[model samples]
Target: MSELKIVDTGNELRLLGMDEASKLLGIQKSTLYDMTMRRAIPVVKIGRLNRFKLSDLEAFINQNRQEAQS
Candidate 1:
């Protein structure tokens, strides 16, 4: 599996879990789970664990925002 990196506030990077990703994205766990179920969100599954990179989530949000504006 590839590495998951998170860009910190200080411009540093680290790995993050589902809970952290949800909190950072300002969404509920169930909502994140729903997105995953619909394959609407990008995720990394390692073994039985699911993870997400901050950059990926940000990109997803940006893409959605642009779509909404259009």
Candidate 2:
């Protein structure tokens, strides 16, 4: 995956490339790819390319968030 910059239009869903998604999640590209392959993360297929939605990524983070046991 390349560090491709996706254009954002008003009222349109924001899509990100693998590199951007990995960076946003603070993980390596390989890890992200593994998660995608395992179906652990939501991904969008754009005709031979992988894309991630900003809203979906945010939802994934929220779903996986764990509260600290104090």
lDDT (C-alpha, whole model) for all candidates: 0.75, 0.83
* Candidate 2 Cα errors over 4 Å, as ranges: 1-11
Task: Give the deviation of candidate 2 from the true structure as CA RMSD.
Answer: 7.8
Lowest-sum lDDT 10-residue window in model 1: 1-10
lDDT of 2 by residue, 1-70 (tens): 2333434564468788999999999999999999999999999999988899987777788778776787
Clashes found in each candidate (C-alpha, N, C closer than 3 A) = 0, 0
TM-scores for all predictions: 0.70, 0.81
Per-residue lDDT over 1-70 for candidate 1, one digit per residue giving the tens place of the 0 to 100 score: 2233444685334446889888987899999988987999988887888788667787777666532253
Q: Which residue pairs does candidate 2 place in steric collision? A: none
Q: Could you tell me how far off, in angstroms, the CA of residue 63 lies in candidate 1 after the best superposition?
A: 0.7
